[model samples]
Target: MNDSLDHDITAFLDTWTLDPNQTKSCFLDLKAHLDGLDGVRCEFVSRPGITYSLRAAHANQKKRGLFAMVDVIDDDPADRWLSVCFYNELVDDPKDMGDEVPGGLLGEDAKCFDMYESDDALLAYIKERLGAACHSASCE
Candidate 1:
């Protein structure tokens, strides 16, 4: 993992009041994997929700870049949850990740899911999807 990115992630997690062990372990794990890949930059957006997005250029420069994945944290604590949106252009069923999928997602390409447990299978699945998204691309 890149040091700056690692620091940024830790800082973000620190800002949240939610239990890091309970709600953020999966995301932190995912972030660790993403950090090892090249050109897979992370973008943090604070709006209606705090969203950390992973992005990469597609195989064809003319084509749209892939909005690989995003982890969102809502404003309300009780309503707070981590949501991962995997781009469907390169993934079949992002919502049906190896683990259970969370509710509140509706879109062809915006398939969302939430991870509450540490599942190696799920991480491997995500890595596969990421490879597809970066196929022949400069992602890295």
Candidate 2:
């Protein structure tokens, strides 16, 4: 939310080391990538931060666990790049949790769990880990 913080953070990102700026750059890159996707903002769920994939949502329609939801936490003293991590959801089954999960979210595969700082990396996760999680009933 803080543009100035973003600026400083990005400055740190270019150094090729783990710093607060790396986190900012990562987030900024994400914002830019998601924005360019379909002209719609990548909805961010803060407090317990994460990213939602509208495209995946549309594709799956009735099914969620198709999109990406990155989880951010304050692991460091300053709370920067390393702390802001991402993870996708697995549907396992449509009826497993019903409406609790959002549309297009992916789940059901253990491999889906991974960390990323870029949209591209996140996308790879969807194709790999989350993509494998089947509808909950299948597990039953």
Number of the top TM-score candidate: 1
Off by over 4 Å in 1: 1-8, 48-62, 94-108, 116-120, 136-140
Measure candidate 2: CA RMSD.
Answer: 10.1
Question: What lDDT does each candidate get?
Answer: 0.54, 0.35
Please, what are the lDDT tens digits per residue for candidate 1 over residues 1-140?
Answer: 45775676667677766654355666666666665666555654445465554444343434444445556465554345556664444446554663333332233345555654455676567666655555534433
Query: Model 2: how far is 125 from its true place, Å?
Result: 10
Instruction: For candidate 1, give the lDDT.
Output: 0.54
Candidate 2, residue 135: Cα displacement in angstroms equals 19
Best by lDDT: 1
lDDT of predicted model 2: 0.35
Each candidate structure's TM-score, on Cα atoms with residue i matched to residue i, is 0.61, 0.38
